[model samples]
Target chain A: MIRFENAHIGYDHDLIEAIDFELPNSGIIGLFGKNGTGKSTLFKTIIGLQALRRGNIFIHHQNISEIPGKLLAKKVSYCPTQILSYGNLTVWDVVSNGRIPHLSWLGKLKTHDIELVENSLELMGISDIKQQLISECSDGQKQKAIIASALAQETSILLLDEPTAFLDYPSKQELLKQLSFISEAGKLIIVSSHDLDLFEELCDLKLLLSHHKIITSEDTDFNKYWDEFTTKGLAK
Target chain B: MTTGKLTYLLLGLLLLVLFILGIGLGSADIGFMEAIKSLFKSADSSPEAYIIQELRLPRSLVAILAGAGLAVSGLIMQTLFTNILAGPHILGVSSGASLFVALTILAGSTLGDMSLPFAAILGALTISSLILFASRMLSSGTILLIIGVMIASFCSACVSLLEYYADSSALRSFVIWTMGDFSAVGKTHLPTLAVFVMMSVAICFAFSKGLNALLMGESGAHALGFRVKSLRTWILFITAVLAGSITAYCGPIAFVGLAVPNLVRFIVKTANHQVMIPLVLLTGACFGLLCDIISRLPGDDRTLPVNVASALIGAPVVIIILLKYQKSIR
Candidate 1:
């Protein structure tokens, strides 16, 4: 489990504060917020990219701040929302990079590393397109490739920031379904999305970013936030 | 054969052929057999032997070193900026090196034979770090590119100021350097240039895996355990060393760094830096040797400047490759 204690997180100043929560080690977490809310910042803080303002974050009973980057990488994988154009990189090449921390300095992939890459590709159902350049992959396929790369890392905790932003409806559903399935494999998967319906239907837990605080609850309370989202939209 | 192996075989042959051509096809018109004999003989008193051993051999070595150095540096820059057009010269590194050379010339400061190159390296290092810090402040590649060009123009303006104050002799020397040549450094300097260039390439290969991870984007690389900021900084540092040393020796020879990696990428059709680095090195050396040979103009007593030859040769090849891979570039 990942536990946040009085977590105040942001880049410059605290965008959200008092984020006290314990995320179960194996479940699907839906992070939902308005455009300017601190969902991405929270994820960044947990993944050690952004500094926490005033708090302790513990991953698997070890303080996150004390863990080395490579060790931390082995435990948590982060997927950014924007996928930049990677010139000439095939799906296999991109996925293979996830084995970086696992490989030695020379980075000659071991047989097991290669097998993990293949397994991740198969898990993401992108084995057929493994040889295709990332630039040529469709938006949905590219998202899956990114997720496959994260999976290839074999981390226990996976954090994705707006993974479905540019994906179409079916693509979004497929990606979320994959995330839910991944959580079922005993990995903690946290995905930030605007898809309220999918979150209600697929996520085991939901964390709502509102008014500079994180409100956590089970999916039974998602309806409360849906009404809140629509009323806020109507008021605006 | 795979493209990689074929690229290796063809490049190796090209290097050999160009090495021979570089030695034999200069204005002296020595036979290939005579050049070979002269290369092995220590006491051949013939002017042909002297030229072959003293001038032509060092020039060939320097050409290969500078060419391969610039090409790999260009590859790293292209990867760092994620732009197909990025090169050693694009970020004003050459101009930065040139400005320092101008300062040393105009001031009449003497730092020994190695001082000028060291000064150039310092200049390149300073300017690269400035641009890197600017990258932290700005996110747009286009903005960073504009900043790099502006820095180049600024360095050129500084060079112009130094030129205005310089004596005619110093002015002439600076102008000659600007024109670019492979003949300036003699046998004395080749060992040092060879060592530095070799070390730079080694460092690049050591970081090739991390560099490959960088292609996935900075955050992605970071998540995969590569320190993106340090990686970028180290890349710039290595590029400065390679490019600065080349500029210090070869006077900022153009287009090899810009064009060679693009050409290699087109031929190989993969983004694996492990494969690309060695290929770029070999192809770059061959390309450089070829340019050096063409600059000699073989039969003509007067030869073209290497910069002009490189552009004349490299630019069109790059343009053709770009045209063919236009969609991929975007």
Candidate 2:
């Protein structure tokens, strides 16, 4: 379970405030907000990439700030929006990096780590292209590679910032199906995306960012709440 | 053997051949067999033995060390900044050493032979610390790179000002040093240079995992639970020590640091640091030996400057590789 208590998330100034909520251990939790609505900042705060200005975040009943980075990595994995394409890293290389926190100092992957990496590649359906350089991969393949990397972490909570951004319509549907499968396998995934229609069909719960606050709603009530929130111009 | 293993074997063999050639084909023109034989002979056995064992051996060893050190430094800087153009000198390390050497030479300091190397190390570390502080204040790698370039330009300006006012003899000595020579390092200074360079290389190898993680950029590495700030600190310190000590002993030999790693990457076609680190080290040693052999010119009594030979050899290889890998270089 992840819980935020009066959390203020932002750099310098709080882009979102009074963010008090508790999420269950497993399911797809859709985070909905327009641009500049603090969706990414909220994700950053939850991953401890950004500090919580005025409140506490509890992961599995333990305060998140108390966890060391390596330990936190085992609990929460994040896939950012922009992926780096400069290095000559192969798909295998990028995906295997997810095992770094668990690997020895030399970063020699043991049998178990290798299996996990392989499984992630298979799960993301990029196993055939494992030897292909990420720089040469298409945008959608790169997106899947990044997601597979996050999956290889085996973290309890996965935070994906626009995982479907570069994906095509069919790939997006396929990814949503994979996320559903991953959530059913007992991981809490909080994904922020602009594709509300698709997420509505997949997400078990919805959290809307409006008026510098996080308002939680059930999947059934998401459309009603979104309508009220949007009609009121609270997104402004 | 697989292609990767074959590449390693070929590189290792090449390095061995270069080492022997570096020791044999000097101004005295000793045969390869004689060079190998002299290694087992006493230092005072004969003029050939003495020259091979005492002078050329240390010179060649220094060449290997400087080459490997500077090349690895370049690799680290390139990976850290994610820029192919980034080299050890990009962070002002060489310029820092150069400025201090300029001060010591032009100021007419009557200090002993050890004073110049000491001054160079001091200047390099001073600049490295300033860079470390600037890295702390700034979060962006591009910004830090700009700051480093600015610092380097400032140091170069200072060196030019020093060169402008110095006497002719002092100016001449400093200019000759700037041209670079492997023979500048005597037998006595070999141990210090070896220790500093070897230790820094080992530390760099130990951080190979972090370096690989850094290929994803700072935020990605941090997300992987690597302490990006601490990693950056270690990288800076290592580069400073390697580049500093080499510049101190070798008078700022060029091209090896900037080109060798790129060549290795282009040939190997992978950014895996574990594979690249050792390859870069060996290739660099080979490059250094090759440059040293060329500089000596075997039969000619007059030696070409090591820097000139390195540039002459390195520039063409770099240009060709850059053209071939233009799409991937960015």
Candidate 3:
């Protein structure tokens, strides 16, 4: 379980303030917000890339700030919106990098680690492209590869920021389906995207960012909350 | 064997041949067999043995050290900044060394015979510390790169101004040093150069995993549980030590650092540092030996500068790589 207590997120002044929420251990929590709405900042804050301005976050009752970075990596994996294309790294090489936290000081991939990397590629249905260079992959393939890397981390919590930004319509739907399957396997996934209609179809819970606050809604009434959010001019 | 293993084997064999060749062919006319035989004989056994033991061996070893050191330094900088164009000299470490060397040469050297290398190292470390300080204040790698360029330009300008006032002999010697040569390191200084380069290379290998993680950029590496800030600092320090020491001994040997890593990446077709690091070391050693041999020009006593030979080879390779990847680069 993840819980936030009066968390203030941002640099300098708070972009989002007084964030208090509790999320179940397993579900797809769709984070919805317009551009520049602190979605990325919130994700960054949770992953410890950015500090909380005011309060605290707890993962499984352990304060996130107290969790060492290596330990936190085992608990939470993050996939950023844009992946810098390291020209010569193949899909397998990129995905295996997710196993860095679990490896020894030399970062050698043991047999088990290799198996996990293979499984991540298999899960994302990109096993065939494992040998292909990431720079040569299509947008959809690259997105899958990036997500597969996060999966290879084997974390309980995965956070994705604007994952569908560059993906085509069908690719986006496919990626959402993959996330849904991943969540079903007993992992908590918090994904941020502007695709509200897709979130309505797939997400188990919806969290909307409006007026520097997070408003939560159950799956059954997410459409109602989204409608209210959009119609009330709060999305702007 | 797999192609990767095959390529490694081939490169290793090539490096072996070049190592022996580097010892064999120089201003002296020792036959290849004689050179190989001299390797097992005592230094006092013969004139050829004495020459090889005293002069050729140290020179070739220095070449290997400088090549491997500079190449690995370039690789570290390239990965840290995530720019293909970055090299050992990118941070003005070489220029810093040059500035101090220039001062020592032009200012009528108060310090004795060891002054130039000492000054070079001091200058290089000073610039490295400045870059490290600036890195703390500025977050962007691109900005740091610009700062490095600015530092290099300032150092070069200082060097030029010093050149303007020096007497003809001092100016001529300074110009020759700028052209670079592998023969400057003798038996006495070989151990120091070897230790610095080997230590830096070992440290680099130890951080190969972190370097590979950095391929994802800083935030991505952080998410993977590596401390990006500390890693960057370590990389800078290693680059400084490697570049500083190599430039101190070899007088700013150019192009090998910038070209060899790119060539290895192009051949290996992978950015995994664990695989690339060793390959780069061997390729760089071969490249150094080849450049040294070319500079000597086997039949002729008049030797060309090592920098001219390296640039002649490296510039074309860099150009071809750029043209081949022009679309992506654009």
Candidate 4:
């Protein structure tokens, strides 16, 4: 199981702490907090993208930092918000890149690898746009293409940062439906977003960041959370 | 800019025609038949054959290689920095090579022909390190670009200072070197140059996937499980080797380093570096060869520098790009 024990992350002067947690085995774990509460920092930490300031994170009885970078990629695959700026790539090319972890430094693709990419495209309903460039797709199709990439990673856990930010009604619903299918395969999903209504609809458990630390939704001070969020325009 | 399959197919054909034309015309002007014969090492000993082997062939090859390398470097740099204007010459690296080269000539080092390219390579490495240092200190991409330009301006001032103090003969050498010449390339350096260019171009080809992973920006590549820093560093290294070495040997021929990739993008309408890069390579080679020919058209010692011709070709393209697809390309 993944565990964050007193882990903290800081950037030059700002610091965000992870008090403690034993991540649940298999369900969506929603992250919610005020703007400066370091919700994004915590998600980045779990993925090993941001360096920790103190304490350590462990995956399957081993410290994540100790694992080799390639091995670590295999263990924890992440799906951030759909990248807005990537140009020139098709849905297929972007999705197939998820196999980077399985490939050697030479990075050649085998037949099984092609099958995985195809399977993922079909699963995400992105097969219709498989040859279309990423920039050419609509919002929901882009997000599904992003999910196809994550599914291609074939990991036990998926970590997404604001999976539904800037999405419209039907687009957000389409993404939520995709996420539901994803979480059904005993896959553990962690999504951080301020789309409270949509987020609450999909996530099984919720996490909140406050007081420079992470805590469960049950332990969070709702009045204070909403006050900081409302005042800071974070929860809106 | 309309990239229907037909447009791309026509563009591909147009590029191929330009490449063959490039491989065909040169200083000694061999007939197509004799030139083709010379490639197989069985030409008859006419002046045509000697000219084909000694002058035209190597000159054409250098033009193609240098053009392709510079264009691909610009393409990769533009992608890596995510700035539309990030060309190979922007960071003062080319000027760096020109600087030490001017100094070497002023010193009358007698280091022979090879010393010039070597000195230029040294200058490129130094400037590249400076750019990397500036990047580390500066948070904003625009700031880093300006800082790099500031360094380039400083280097340019130094190049002018050397020109002012030098003897007439030395000054002429420095000026010719700066004008950039494919015709003057020594045969001895060609093999090493070819190998290095091919290897780095191959590296860029390999990184097409990684570069595409990067087209989404650094954070996006990270989420895709790439070591963004490692991949970016390698891209920089490859760009340097390709563009730096070409600038060192050929002087600062301009714009193919800046324009060809964008033209390829315009033609193909795909930013997939995999396809875009090879297109850049071919298109760059063809463009460079064409520019090299244009440099010779005035004749009678009125030959313009290749840089002047390229800037003519490039500036309009840049302006058009800015006016039209600037926002999306950026």
Better of 3 and 4 by lDDT: 3
Cα displacement (angstroms), candidate 4, residue B150, comes to 4.1
Q: Of the native A-B interface contacts, what share survives in model 2?
A: 0.52
Chain A vs. true chain A, TM-score per model, equals 0.93, 0.94, 0.93, 0.89
Candidate 1 CAPRI category: medium
Tens digit of per-residue lDDT, candidate 3, span B1-330: 299889989998998899898899877789999998998899999999998999899889988888888899888877766666667576787899889988887878632257766787788878877876786687566688788889999999999899998899889878888888888778888888898899989999999889988876666787888778888878877787888878877887878877999888778777888888999998998889889988887456778889989998999988887676543331
TM-score of each: 0.94, 0.92, 0.93, 0.87
TM-score of chain A of 1: 0.93
**Candidates' lDDT values, in order?**
0.84, 0.84, 0.83, 0.74
Q: Write the per-residue lDDT of candidate 3 for residues A1-236, one digit (tens) a residue.
A: 89999999889998888988799999998898777779988888887888899999999999989999899889998898766655477888889999988989887889999999999999999999998877778877888888899999999999998788888998887888889899999999999987777787788888988678777884465567678778876552
Tens-digit lDDT string for candidate 1 (A1-236): 89988989887888898878789989988888888788877877776778899989999999989988889999999888866655577888888888888888877888999999999999888999998877787877878888898999999999988888778888777777788788889999998988776676788887888778777774466567657865776312
Off-target runs (Cα >4 Å) in candidate 3 are A218-225, A232-236, B105-122, B125-151, B167-170
Error of 1 at A214 (Å): 1.3
All candidates: CA RMSD in angstroms?
Answer: 2.3, 2.9, 2.8, 3.8
Least well predicted 10-residue stretch by lDDT in candidate 1 chain A: A227-236
Candidate 3, after superposition: displacement of residue B149 in Å? 5.5
Tens digits of per-residue lDDT for model 4 on B214-328? 7655565776567888887787777777776787678877778777877776666566675687778878877888787777776444567888878889989878766655334
Model 3 chain B — which ten-residue stretch has the worst lDDT? B321-330
